[model samples]
Target: MKKNQNFRFEKKNRTKLKIKIFSLQIMEFVTHCENSESSTTSSIIPEMETSSQIVELALSVERADTAALLGADESNIDTLEKKRLEEIRQQQISQAKLMAERRQKKAAMGMEERQNWEQEIERYRIENEEVEERQRRLDIDETMEEFYPKLCEWVGLSNYEVLYNSLEDGTNASDLNKKICGEKNVMFIIITKTGYAFGCFCHKKIPYPKKSYIYSMYDKKYFTFSLRNPSCSEPIYFKQKHKGKSICIWPNDEKNFIFTTKRFIKIKNPNGPHGTRSFFHGKFSLKYKSKDHQKREHTFFTQTTAFDVHRLVVLHWF
Candidate 1:
């Protein structure tokens, strides 16, 4: 009976130990489930809000001023950027207003300025014309002053008499008689509106200026040239051989004479010997380097004025 009682006690002790072990297992399972649920809930929720994240959200909503004031950056970078943009906008507005004001001022002054500009142009043109006319007179004065001094040098006269000067008397002999024409043994130099001159000695007292060739005294021709005729070649007389003009006392004083037909006793080209000779007359070509000597003579008939002369000892232009 005691052995059976010991066996029953051992079985009861074993049953108690199994019950405690089962309770421990159940407690552990519940704790693990609670921990997992708590971790999952924590993961679903969010962390506490930071200052930079709040600033970013505010700026995204176009509230930069609020973001900048409440920011932890402490730099006020947004405020500085706003001020710079405002300044640029103000500058553009001010420039547009200034340009409008300038346009209005120019429109108001246009008519008065146009009138003044026209007046200024007219005055300038008149002043320019006056300057030109003054220059022309000065040129004529210079030419007149030059001709007389050069005449004295060319004539090389030791003693001479000025019996008449057309400038003092008159240039035209057509109105006056032969009394105005100087006496025999007198010489003459005619100054005309044309640039060149005409000069000769009167062998006898001529009645009319047009018929003075019959009384012509001078044998040599005189003219001005830039280049000297240095070649010592003989002269060719084309008019004498071709046109029956030999030993001519040219009607140089006659204004009505034909221009091309008028001839002078002179060699044309005395530079060098070449094939360039006058027609019908070789070894002599009546070349004219300067102005035509007969052209100056024609002026004596109509416009022969302002002339003076001296007796030539022996006139030969060499």
Candidate 2:
């Protein structure tokens, strides 16, 4: 009986211990669930805040776009498009009209008539070109008559040929040398813009070896002359006073032709934008006897000390 009583008491105690362990497990599970819930809430709060910020930004952008749309001028865009289209339409119409006119003109003419018309146009073009060429040749002939014969006579060169004209060849030094370097006699004729004309005669080959800023002192045949002078009635000849200096052929931006040096007669910038600048001095001209038995005052060809050139012509003969 005592054993049965003790067994029943132990069984009751075992049931009580099992109930206490189950209660403790339940409490622990509830605490774990609460912690999980709290953690989830904490994690979600920042996400929710970010989403709200994004929503606010989207709303602001939408409002700004809406304001821009409202403020924009639809009429301006429509007007610009219409104007562009109208211009295109007008251009197309004009082109169509031109094409139709051309076709109608073509159709109106017979094949023979078209050939005749083309021939007539060609004749006119040829005649025009011929006329221009004749006029140019006439002008050159006049210049030749005025200076060519006289220059040849003075230089004692009968058999000669035209070498280089600036209007035809070019105003380059290399080109000048190519045309007139080997020749024994060369004459330079320069006409100024102001209608004054002058030139240099080099008996020696051009670009004479004896270059002098003062005087060449060796070349007796080298001389300068004024063809057309406003002050002088006749074409005045300038004998080289400082012992017949050889004419200098200046090159590459120095001077086109240098007749004398130290009170020099020269032309600068032959083909430049400002045209050619010519310098003439009183000492260049030879002194003449006056009627009053007195020394005539020195005079230059251009009247003025300097003038701009109009044309430069170079002729040579072997």
Candidate 3:
């Protein structure tokens, strides 16, 4: 019984030791397996991370290419816009040049027109002056023809005889009357001392009531006379000296006479009816008396009643 009990105790002790050993081996094996698995997972994680990075780099490259293409398109658009703007500027410059040329042409045309108008006006002015001159000459010729016959009838003589006698005697009478009647122009007249036996000629008309005088005569006297045509007078008488010795008195018309004497004398009635008469007094005298036994005082008388007593006295020494 005692041997059996000791043997049972030993067997129980062995069984416990075996159990502990087996547990320890199982733990070690589990630990070793866990470590191996952990290392392998770490390596696999690194490979996966590297693959993801490669994918990311590829995506970045694609995005970069797309951006470059877009930038190229933008640059092209900017170039096109610049070209268009330059074209517009060129068009504007062309239009400005066209306008400048047009204005210059218009100004040149206006200057040409103004010059033509001035030339036309000058031509018209010269034409008008020539026409006026022609008309004046025609009128003068017509007037001379109409009055020539009337002057001859009024003077009670033929035209040829009046012209011939005037030239021969150096007289201005026929010429003066012709001028007054518009037959000729009368410049001046030669008158005797008595205002009669005078001569005149002219190519123009003379104003009426013309009178003139001679200064010194053969009788030492000044003689003045006047020729006048009154409104109601028929027979004209020639009047003589105011206060002097007179000789060879000749009657010109009513209130007109001439005297030959040795000295100049002033007339009392110097003015005429029309205030158009002229009086001329000469500077020298004529000697007409005999030497010894010559009568120094003599008076000549006219039968005509139309003479003015105060202004027409003729005195001479015989």
Per lDDT, the best of the predicted structures is 2
- Clashes (candidate 3): 37
**lDDT by residue for model 1 (1-318), tens:** 999999999978865554455445445656766777554423432332565743444354456556766684557777788899999999989999999888888876886798899899999999998877445423434333444344444445434454444334332233222333434334333222222333333334433344444333332432221110113112111111232222212233333211111243121111213321211111222422214343233222223322122110112121
Error of 2 at 118 (Å): 41
Which of the predicted structures, 1 or 3, would earn the higher lDDT when compared with the native?
1
lDDT of 2: 0.61
In terms of TM-score, the best-performing candidate is 2
- CA displacement after TM-score superposition, residue 125 of candidate 1 (Å): 14
Each prediction's RMSD over C-alphas, in Å, is 20.4, 26.5, 29.4
Query: What are the runs in model 2 whose C-alpha is more than 4 Å off?
Result: 1-138, 208-217, 252-262, 270-276, 282-299
- Angstrom error at residue 100, model 2: 60
Worst 10 residues of 2 by lDDT: 288-297
Per-residue lDDT over 1-318 for candidate 2, one digit per residue giving the tens place of the 0 to 100 score: 999999999988965665455445545656767877554433332232356644654575578778888668664798889999999999999999999998888887766698899999999999999877445433545666766677667888766667877677766555555676656677777776655666767776554333333233466676666677666466645555546455554443334452334344655656546445666655433422233221222345666766776667777755
Error of 3 at 41 (Å): 36
lDDT of 3 by residue, 33-65 (tens): 687755433323223235664465446556877
Q: Candidate 1: deviation at residue 41, Å?
A: 14
Better of 2 and 3 by lDDT: 2
